[model samples]
Target: MHHTARKFSLSVTAILASLLVTLSPHTFAAVGSLDLTTSGIGYFSLVLFVIAYLLVMGEELLHLRKSKPVLVAAGIIWMLLGWVYTQEGMPHEAEHAFRHTLLEFAELMLFLLVAMTYINAMDERNVFDALRAWMIRKGFNYKTLFWLTGFLAFFISPIADNLTTALLMCAVIMKVGGEDKKFINICCINVVVAANAGGAFSPFGDITTLMVWQAGIIPFQDFFALFIPSLVNFGVPAVIMSFFIENKKPDALDEAVEMKRGAMRILALFLLTIVTAVSCHTFLHLPPVLGMMTGLGYLQFFGFFLRKTLPGSLARKRAIAESRGDQAALRRLGDVVPFDVFSKIARSEWDTLLFFYGVVMCVGGLGFMGYLALMSEVLYTGMGATVTNIILGVVSAVIDNIPVMFAVLTMQPDMSTGDWLLITLTAGVGGSMLSIGSAAGVALMGQARGMYTFIGHLKWAPVIALGYAASIAVHLWINADLFVK
Candidate 1:
């Protein structure tokens, strides 16, 4: 399957490349005036985008990485656009557009890199393990565990991200539920829903919200404005799902996993990093990425201290003496590896990050070609902004929200602040309507495997759709001031 997918992708790229070469002169001349909507290149760009996106959507079945087709498509589209600028004898214009795309991609990647590093550092410290151990030790009833995991996913996702939070919460559910497949399945759904919803209200939560915040379409304070609506989104489904859970208590584990040294300290530092990032963005007139990187520096310093200073501290001396086996104790300490940021970066979601790059360029190419203008007119003007934004969420469920949100951002539709918030809310939570919709849902599918399949999530789609609609309605009512304009 993988080999066949690779061959298919290469063939597509080659065909697209040949077409670009054949149409190079005409394409470049057509884009000279920045009005390609009537040109052949414009329609061609749209076709390429759709094909690339479809390949991305069928990633699982194709056994192809989502990044491959889109990356190739992005390059081809931009190359074609660049050709247009070249033929127009305005090469600088193409450079400018490419530079703009690169800049945006850099800002987003840096921000994600720092955030992911902090998350990886925390994982290295066994922070999640500590929480999981506590839950298992508590031996909570199924209903209690259900709600607890759901709410935790809701709140923690705003900081840790929805995909990671869902996976962590799923681990807890799997641990507690043991062989109860039904219990695990429902809780997984609830966690995916709650995590995605929770992520909607915070800039750090979902990629869509972050993009909106970073693009300056919405103020940082306005992100909190959706908190209530996001809560409603999660709470409604959680309440409905709670009644479906059995009340029996889970079995306690025979042993608990001990947390690594500096686990609590690392967690505290992670919180401080969040504060630093927010403060920098709110007052320092700096990008949130700067503050996050600053915080990462702090962690690196502390990691060095742990790797160098702590082992030789008086506390270690006392423990060494007590053990009467310095070599053995030293060996144990040696087993505790320091937080290596580079390794974290290597392990981070490279595919997702690369996909963002492709999506940005592809959308930028479309915008330059004026496809976005047409989309804005159709969706915002024809369908009405409210309905269009709501529909965007539904589209997000079918495809990844990252590209959907990017395309919307590129379009820069003329809408009120409330409309922007509506799109943000829908894009983030709408993915919960289907198992493959959001990263959180898709990830849980792999994590829980046979226990929580697409069919299982589909069974609960209506309940999730209810939450999706109710949350939008709630946002419309409570935050109506945003729509006043």
Candidate 2:
């Protein structure tokens, strides 16, 4: 399946490349580059983008990595655009636009890299595993675990990211759910909603919010304003789903799992890193990536400390275990390994990071070609800010929010800070309405597989839609003051 998909992707790229080369010079002459948005090249570029995105959307079924299609599309789109500009005697414009887009991608890439590394480090240190084990040992009833996992997803996502939060909480649900498909379905839906909602109110939560923050559209502290609306979004669907959970408890497990040494310290360092990033951005007027990179340094040094102490730590643990005659302790101690920061960095989500690069560049290329201007005039100008922003949220459910938000940022629409926040909130939480809408949802579907399918999620879509609409209303009402110029 993988090889077939790769061959298919290469074939598509070759065909598109051939078409672009054959058509470019003639198309440029006919359209004359005066209005690239409606030019032959513009239409061709749009078609190429659509083809790329269609491949991206079909990633699950096609067994192809989402990054492949878009990366190829980006290269082809830019190559055509650059060729047109050179013919028009304006090569510098294309150069400047491409460089600007690259710069934007670089900042976002580095920021996400640091964040993913921290998440990977904590995973290595058994932080998430410990949390999972604790939840399983508690043996909470289905209803209690339902709300517990949902609430944890909400709060944790603002810091840990919705995708990771959902995956972790879904693990707990799958363990406790056993053979109950009903329980798995409802709980998975709840986690997706809660994780997305939680992320809506924090800059660190979702990529959309992070983009809004990095673009200077909203201040970091101002994001907390969405907390109530975000809570309402999760709460509405959760209340509806709670009654569906059976009032039974899973059998308890006696497994005792312990975190590796330095887990707590690594967790603390992550928090400190977040603080450092926020401070540098807020107080020092520096890019937040600078602070995040610095935080990576902290982890590196701490990892060095752990590596240096591992031999002695192991010796002491062996001595204590031998004295106490605890074979289990000695056996566990044997499993202890040196913590390598570089290994954690390597394990970060390279696919997602690379996908971001593709989306950024592709959207950036379209914006450079004038699609964003056309879009802005039609969406924000023709429809009004409030209606347009709300529509954007719905749009996010089908198309990934990263490109949608990137296009919006590139368009640089004129609107109040409140309107900006509205778009940010909508884009962040809107993906909850569908099973494939958000990363959290898509991930949970995979994690819970046969038990939690798209059809199962669709059954609850109306309920999720209610929460989506309610969230918008709550945002408009609660943040009314910001909307007033």
Off by over 4 Å in 1: 1-32, 313-334
lDDT of 1 by residue, 1-485 (tens): 12222222222222211111111111211222578887898788888989988998788799899888889999998899889888999888877767766765666566666676666667766677778788888888999999999999999988777877888888888877878889999999999999999989987777777767766567778989899999999988889989998889867775466666677887888789878877886788666767777887888888887777664564665586568866856655656655565676565545655666687677777777877777788888899989998998998898778767767776777889999899999999999999999877877777778888899989989989998999999999999999987
State model 1's lDDT: 0.76
Best candidate, TM-score: 2
Model 2 vs truth, CA RMSD: 6.9
TM-score of model 2 vs. true structure: 0.92
Q: For candidate 1, which ten residues in a row score worst on lDDT?
A: 17-26
How far residue 135's Cα lies from its native spot in candidate 2, in Å, is: 1.3
lDDT of 2 by residue, 12-33 (tens): 2222111111111111112123
TM-score for all models, in order of appearance:
0.89, 0.92
